[model samples]
Target: MGGLLSILKGGAKEEEPIDIPLNFGAQPSGPEIEYYNAVAGLMRAAPGILNDLRSYSGCGEAIRQAISNPGKATEDAAWAVVCPAVAKLKDYYDFSCALGNAMGAHAGADQQAPVVSPTEQLFPRILSFLGNGDASQNFEQSQALARKLAEILDFATQFDNLKARSASQPAGQPATMSNPNVQNDFSYYRRTVSRMKMNNAQSVAVVSDEVANKMSLFFAHSNPVTKALIDSANVAVMSRTLSLGGATDVFSILAGVSYHMVAKGRAGNDSAFFLRVMVVSVLLYDHIDPAGAFIKNSKINIKASIKVIQSSGGSGADALLNALRFSTQHLNDETTPKAIKQMLAQ
Candidate 1:
């Protein structure tokens, strides 16, 4: 709350703006201009998307307020802000998935000189994988990760806890959790909460009162949303469903349970759908991102969740994994070690 975000806001530094013509990696040729134009249109529309991205700010703000003010009113305000933001974010996420899908189909169609796909645009490094017109020569470090994701998504799609409601045993998924209780208390099974201290909201936000107040300062970088999600997930009594708050990050719970219940799917409804996309997003983020401190020196746990998912695959595993791979194929980030290393690769 105070350190990272505040530093980002308050740290005074002088910088000179480079007046340079920027293009999205396009040469000033024919097709390149076409691509650049598309990118420009996207850039023009970026504000709306950016707004959606920053919409999480509301919850972030509410999180800070809850920590600083500390009261029932503050807690309720946080919940109100967070829930709606999550709902809206899910829709935006769905759109991104659809865009990724279209990107893949198009890229696949062109074998010889593959045209750049939108997926590659978001994650430009993927374009580097096309190889020297030879599949064998391509950069494929992610295949190992992809196959693992495929298994998980495949497992999730087949798992339909609602099927149990219809009759008794659902054939789609005969294999529930070997230890269902693991989902209830992720920490008992997987250890992601070694450092995070929690107070009980005892409500949906999951923790509140004097407990949240006293320790608020220690957790300034994180919002109450994270604490609630982790706490609710740790002791959730869900079945093929998880506490809605866990949508903050499914860790690997979505692998077993398709969606989050409120009050849930392999993506049955919006929340499920959102979580489905989010699971992959977090996993992909973990696969490439480092164990070192993120931009904010933030305390959010990214690696532990994927460690669980990769250890035991999840629903729509193959499809989701494929979509994500295609979506991010062209993506590049110099900030990530993997990408930097790849750029240096011969």
Candidate 2:
């Protein structure tokens, strides 16, 4: 009976079992994931790709050099080197455009972050202003400057907040006011503002009469330190203008103003009042253009402007101004006038 049962079990099991194969092919990725992956791959591949292109360029340059020298190399040999380089260059061009288009499409779809250029990354505030349209582009240019001013205000707010928090804390508890990082940041802020004040003073010296008047008006109700800086700048401008036979070249004035602001920021004395003046002056200068204001029939909003300056009290403001400076420096003179026009329109 045991043997019969074992035979029956074996026979039942012997019935052919069906084997189903499972396919685990690649799954489709989401748009965002695909974009991120593409970006990551590009980032990783960029250095190698650039290096390869450089090598090709070098090879082409070497061939060109050889061809230029007398009896250095035959034309056919040069052509061999040149032709391949040219072909590779064409491939690179195609690849670059394709990648750019892909990235742009992804960004347009809001599926991925916009790919920032090296220059834009270094000067992020300028990114806001980069546009094809006149009005939109012009509006973007001031964004950095405005943001910087706002940041300065934020710093002041932060300090005030810290003070308030400390005051509210238990009497036996330690205060954040004593934190080294906080103190250092505040010190940095002071130094940065002092520098800005020096720059504003310098710019004030070289600006056009109309601009100077506007600046004076802008600072009329500002802190005493700002007023003092403006006075000094005006004196310098008067001397310089007189020496130059009262030449009011807008470009020269702008250049001087920009230079002085940067220099002052680098070398000015650090103080809260000085910092406030610096921030206010720089922002006023950036926004206050006689030509633009005249074209737009606009007047400076003193109360609003004052509020902007007061509120700008953080490290982010400094970063924004730095970016604005970079953008301004890089922009062409022709474009600058247009940008100014746009600012005035606002």
Candidate 3:
């Protein structure tokens, strides 16, 4: 507490006010606006978000270092909290990476406006907006993130529910993860064991480069998320529900994942149910998305999915359909389809 006080002595630099632009054809209203307001600052100034994340992530390492050098944190905890050595802490210099990219795709003065990334480079780059980073992580498509999610979130015991969902999947059908846009997101999932020929690898042929260019419209567990969890779940279901606390779970992932970008904003992730509320968003959206893989096999309605997760009285269903109210900039972007954005807003 004493250490946090010193940083308050310095005056923060002034910058132009930034706008939070989440395009939903028409302006987003009600919960959508509230959700947008919640994350707009982070998207607009994602670097600041990164710093907060870095500060949070630094706590574990800082304690280890602080133990080795007593009074270092008390002498200069501000720098210590940000994870720089007290000696180097004074050298801290910041670049506002998201300031340029916020609003529209503002180009660097040296760069040409016409040559912006073929795909939009979202502000505060952590989102990679159009890319599948956030989505895949939420839906358990990212193998690494899911393993961690299992270790931390309160849903480990629900693995059977997940397996049952997967087991229920009929062979040769359109999976929730079949969307071509998010298909490349699973590049890491394409692997072949020693004896599994293309036949065993889910096909007689799967061209890596052209995997997305063209392919059969139907597949079984080729969806890496299902394939990864199916075998892992069959081996064991966690007896205990492991969780890093809802706030920690959500904040840690956002902080860890937002690397090249940083943004600042928001006040209310404090709903006693904030983590559940936010997580619920991820689940619901994933369910709604054509490529949503969490409940890839279910034909349930999105609202029903939301209701199941939101109303514990009714049962949180599988509890995988909700999103963080990840209220992410995705809803803010023009790329998001109107109907989906409207649905997400509610």
Q: RMSD of each candidate?
A: 23.9, 31.3, 26.2
For candidate 1, write residues 154-246 as lDDT tens digits.
222222122111233332332222212212122111111222234422334223332222222212211111222222222221221332222
The deviation in Å at residue 273 for candidate 2 is 34
Per-model TM-score on C-alpha atoms: 0.22, 0.23, 0.20
Residue 338 of model 1, lDDT score: 54
Q: Which stretches of candidate 1 lie over 4 Å from their true place?
A: 1-29, 32-34, 47-79, 91-346
Task: Report, for every candidate in turn, its global Cα lDDT versus the true structure.
Answer: 0.29, 0.29, 0.27
Q: Flag the better candidate by TM-score, 1 or 2.
A: 2
Instruction: Name the lDDT of candidate 2.
Output: 0.29
Tens digits of per-residue lDDT for model 3, 191-250: 221223544543332243232222211122223222222212211112112121222223
- Cα lDDT of candidate 3 equals 0.27
The TM-score of candidate 2 is: 0.23
Error of 1 at 345 (Å): 19
Compute the lDDT of residue 310 as modeled in candidate 1: 35
lDDT of 2 by residue, 1-346 (tens): 3332232123123311111111112232332233334334444443454455333322434444544663426533543444444344334323332232212222222354345353212111221122112312222233333223223222322222222222234322222233222222223323333554766732111233333333233222212122222232233233342121111111122222223233335313332333333333333233323232112122222222222333442443332333233212212234243543343221
Model 2 bad stretches (over 4 Å): 1-31, 41-44, 54-73, 102-346
